[model samples]
Target: MINPLAQFALLLDADLMAAALQQHLPECQAGDWQVTGCEIQHPRYKTYRLAENRDRSFLSLVYHLRGRHPAETTAEQRILYARAYLGQRSQQAYTEAQANGETAIHLAELGMVGWRFPDDPAMPWLAELMDSRQIAELEQRPISTIEIVNYRPEIRCTARYRFAASETEPARVVYGKTYADERGRAVYTNLLTLQRQSVAAFVMPEALAYDAGHHTLWLEGLQGHMLTELDFTVGVAEKIPALAHALAAFHQVTPPPLLVITSQQQLKEWLKKADKLSHAYPTIQPALTGLFNELRQDCPEFEVLGLIHGDFHIDQLLVLADGRLALFDYDELAIGDPLQDLANFAADLYNYPYPVAVIDQLVQTLFTAYSAANHNQTDAQRFVWHLRGQLLTRAYRCFIQQKSAAPQRVADFIALALRPWPLAD
Candidate 1:
């Protein structure tokens, strides 16, 4: 009889699944990042973390199908109950492990279909999509072979494909991103539409193909120097203008159809979520809450209901060899106050190198370019408020994600939050 663990891994790549399982349950010492302990209440929901920092932090993946209870008032008790249940499950898994030599996790039991198929040189549908689209970059050649470069389980797969024809064809150098589920499929589809609309106005990846059934998207690999990769102090002078111009042009048009945005109500709900993470950031939480209160108290009117790249940042842009700036990753596209994009970009500037003054100058450069190109006359006070709120939320998230951020960096964000917004005067 085939072990359930082996069967589960067949859907995903075998090695990847083993690496995850091997990290936990000390039984597999082949790698570092050992887990101190883990409770497996079900084959589907496995929770574990590094051996040293088990209490301070841990990792957990709860599948959507696992009867996850709705957000309830008694979250503390519910979390306690779930942890206890996981202990019970772990006990059962240990007993089975002793019976058999080894029993890895059975992820497929939880409804996961990993898309790493090594046997088929090419998936039929993928080939058809490329062929039908008549991808000009391919030079009439077909995708000869492929390999999974990266896979984030239940999220996305980054695959690199080689062309069957002449090696010199630009298509030979290609990378594709495949979504794990239907929703990811729809988002990427929307991205293609937005990309097409921006042509002649913005530099985005050349669309090659969109495979809806499999949720795979192919594009011309720009393979250029990304703005994020450069030292901003050296590159910002030239690159910032191009980025600002592209964004201004994109915001100039009416928002793409069906682009959804969560407005004031969403902000309120997210602030409540921020409250939950308060424990993780005791020192910063006070300032954060104050800004949150300000945002909540003064819900400003949208002077311009314009387009925004909801998740814009330095990393989302590229400085191609041909002296053009390109943008990618449209997953967070939304229709909102255009200033939101500027605020998002400013916050991201902190992530790069250089002194606060240098960062501030770059931001000002972008803002100046934006204002000149688009002629936005939004109220200065409103821009200040919007930027403050953006800094607050960004600080909260930065503290949450990078817990070890320097005290000074957190302080910088707080100061930015409280100070009058840049370009306000």
Candidate 2:
């Protein structure tokens, strides 16, 4: 039996994939751009990061099924949709090609579907926001420059707006985030609620404004380095108690109405992810299926839903100059099992490109501190269950994200999840 995604596997073959991408991509057709990396963005899409041979400037090119297969969007309709956001002048931004039997739409960074608003100057609030008037906390000044902090094509873009220094005030920086849809409004609301609560264990950067028309959210720039920058093998332990306390305090807060995801729902998602992984890496299908079945058989029936940072990880935490920890990226905040946050954080530690023993020590310290701070609310058995589930989820993410040493990491994570109950001392 031929796997439906067998053809897509070619996208991961660095050599073949790069050759194909360079051949079809309009900008790369001249042979100046080379594929630097590629990762699965969605089941039907992959993003190939290309670098120019001269200066090495990066551009993201997405190979997706726009008006194809499951979506049923026609090629003509897809082209029209992209042109609508990018204007008619963007004739060279996308070109279609066949990947096996599928019609794959290759879109350049600026012409990415559903997320062209960030580059659209004509957006209703863009000029005002770009001019730095949207930041009420800062003394208004002319914009000196703008820097794109991070961009995930077809998802979101975060840019830093730096204002020129005035006689009385120093230059200030504010962040603006544009989403593919109205999701930014909800994240803005969550930040507002977090700010009002003022949880002392940590600080949440201020949410400045939300423009529903353009699906953008503005936030005050924070002065901090991400927690991941700290020496995880050494001094990180000292910060664990505070980190644990912050997470505990955050969990107790009454979050605004949000989606409720239970363990059962998560298991269902994992099953789907497992299916995707099996199709992509056929060799692991047997092992993946057996492990998933075991997890399903042992799945916990009870759940305690509460506020959680849906995607909590070390990178999402920042250590401020004043020694306070600031949390960012609340787009995934939801009403779910609080244990999921703890598990998510712990699971992410395994991917840090460090020694397994070092990661194990850090996770143990984190779990100990969290247990103490949360007043032992973490059920021993349930916590382990959540941990195992989170490990599988992280493993799946590692595969799709194309992280360094991904195959080994996925196997290690799955092995850890299958470890006997206490999860090693």
Candidate 3:
């Protein structure tokens, strides 16, 4: 029998996707457009990131075919467009689109929940984020140029504002992040708290400003290298101890007022995520079901909870030009088992595609350094439980992104999670 999901699979193929997009997007007729990235919410909707080959301007196209509404309300397919550009053409598109009675973004909310894009009618502040004059006023400097550093459509966009040196002020770059919701305010508050704590050995990026109305947060952009890109064999390994010490300092600080996630809530969240992924990749349903059950059964009980980077990973780490380590992205800041942060960082170490021996060494070194810096506080059983859970989460991510060798990678992670904690020495 033909797989019903095959229609959506075509979106994953760039060449075929370009051809299909041309049917709806006249710009694709120029043959200079390609699908740069994609996301699938399976059985309901799919989103594709398209870029113009010449200008490199990015746009988002979302297809909504199924929703939780009445059949008549969602029977027909809907195509929604969003662009990162703030130009006359984009404005005209939206205005004329409204005039033409095009499918409004609100109609697709059932499938596009939590998605707030730059071109969203509700996000008028997006234009200000990219506005050169507005940025200059915010920075109190003569802005030279504005460039988008990163944009995860409907989620967040990070833009860099450059200020050329004048007779007085020196050249500098400022970073800004526009959120889809009010979460940016929380992150801004968390950074302020962390900065006041003066965690030794590491620095939190200075929170420049927070626009409550626009849901945008600005920070002092730094010149640095991501820890992930550093050479592990050469000298990066030496920084591992410093990184651990910094993390210890971070854990010592009391997190700002935030939700304290309990063991029961964490279990429910993981199972829910697994259930969602199962719809996207039915092949892994059995494995996921069994693994989640094992995770719940083996869940650890903790007495004291503290501030943890709920989504701690290597990518959130940076090595500044001045040799200070910079940690960022406190959106997932929460009160939970501190081991979750350690396990999360350790799990991310495996994403480097390093040999088993190298990863083992790095993880062992990290754990040892963290223990020493934090007054020899250690819990092997609890740590192992968190590590297994983190590995399972990693497997879910690897599979969700449709990464190469996803099944084997998932199996490898699951297998590792089931094994007894190594590096006990």
Candidate 4:
């Protein structure tokens, strides 16, 4: 009679263990050895030695039957029992994947499944499938069903599943890929149509333009809850009021869960090393260095530190079909002085006509909305201080953009930041 525990240890290899268990345990079926849990106690070759449990702990040893001899037990029986004991492990992995917004593709179900990509590469098989020709083939066909949709470029092309039907009308599916420029610098963008609905509802639908040279993609899909009907030209003066309204609404909403920056200090620290603007604006080095030194001294005091849309500007706001402004791009939402957001709006006003008036209106609208929501003015002075910092920071950003080889909106920003403030006059 083999020791049950010793025999169970040999069944770590799925194939070998399954065969042994099936043979020794006549009651066990092919799928009976479902892996309940597994842990790497030690890595021996390609396998991890694991502690396993079965449904019952009472059956520690074999019992005699019919007075002939004790029921013959083998190493395989022990392995099956161990596998069944570890059944809960897979569920834990599944739960983790869901929490991380990963798309869970059921292998048994051939249809497309949805999943969010996790930062870890623990699933090598899944990684392999993401870059395979199978995905390329799926891309060529009309979008029908999708197994996974990863928004971030780091996890692009990471998906699994079979196409629903060759003849089925493909759903508008957007896929993104990031590549370094000729100089080996990275550029990231959403694939075409992937973010169209979100952009349309929040940002300007008309502003969505594709640059084949830059490889920017915009996909059209599900529109968000907020709807708008206003239409205006890009960089038009007429759009400022609507734009401000949309931005104000965005500022009114609570921040999303994923925003990691909670304070002005934390925001500054993250920006200190982002370095994306370093190549374009060498002036940022001194400005940022000075900002860091004065951060504590210059940091504004605020009564209310509600969620702020970090990059609120004319370009970031959208006029939807219902005549209401919709704010999009929550990538930088965080807890901060609302004035910081207003400052960004003020910084963008110079790009179009009615610079001072537009800036003032936007500020007023944002403040009014914020004040109504929170009913506090404890740090009004502090808000103004932060606003000044934001203006200075915007100026630095403009200076950097101007220094870029092919500055797109730098001149506009510079003009906005340099405009004489109404209070100054």
Top of the candidates by TM-score: 3
Candidate 4 Cα errors over 4 Å, as ranges:
1-136, 143-298, 324-326, 352-380, 403-425
Model 2 residue-pair collision total: 1
Stretches > 4 Å off in candidate 1: 1-151, 162-171, 195-200, 376-378, 406-412
> Which lDDT tens digits does candidate 4 get at residues 1-425?
22222333443344453344334432333333322222111111111112242222111111111111134332221111111112244355455556765544221111111122322222323343344365457357633433443322222222323333456554343432221221111111221222332422244322233334423223333333322122223233455545544444555554444343444664464354323334334544454445444545645443456567677765555444454564544335566656667666654554444445655665555555454544543244454445545554654444322222223344333333334444332
Cα RMSD (angstroms) for every candidate in the order listed:
12.6, 10.5, 10.5, 21.7
Give the better candidate number (1 or 4) by lDDT: 1
Model 4 quality (TM-score): 0.38
Candidate 1, which ten residues in sequence have the lowest lDDT sum? 76-85
Where is model 3 poorest over a 10-residue stretch in terms of lDDT? 106-115
Which sections of candidate 3 miss by over 4 Å?
A: 1-5, 18-24, 30-118, 137-140, 275-290, 423-425
After TM-score superposition, the amount by which residue 35's alpha carbon in candidate 2 deviates from its true location, in angstroms, is 11
TM-score of each: 0.66, 0.73, 0.76, 0.38
Query: Which candidate would rank higher by lDDT, 3 or 4?
Result: 3
- Candidate 1 per-residue lDDT over residues 301-362, each given as its tens digit: 55467777788888777877887888877667777777778777877786665787888888
What tens-digit string does per-residue lDDT give for candidate 2 at 1-425? 23212333454444564455445555345543444434333222332222222122112333322222223333311111122112222233333222122222434433332222233322334434444445544444667777656555456667898877889788888888987678999899878877787565568878999877767898898887878787886657678889998988899888899998988998898897777667556677777887788779867788788999899988888888888888888999889988888888888887777887787778777888888987876676666777888888877877665555667777778787776755423
On a 0 to 1 TM-score scale, where does candidate 3 land against the true structure?
A: 0.76
For candidate 4, give the lDDT of residue 57: 18
Give the worst 10-residue stretch by lDDT in candidate 2. 76-85
- Candidate 3, 1-425: lDDT as tens digits: 23322432454444554344444343334443333323333222222222232222223334322222222332322223333222233454445557754433321211111222335444556767777887778667799987766665557777888898989889988888888889898899888887887557467778998988778898998788988788876456888898889888888897789889776777787786677556556676777787788778777755558998888888888998888898888789899888889988888887776796798788888888988987887776667667877887877776555455666887777667666566442
Candidate 4: 10-residue stretch with minimal lDDT? 59-68
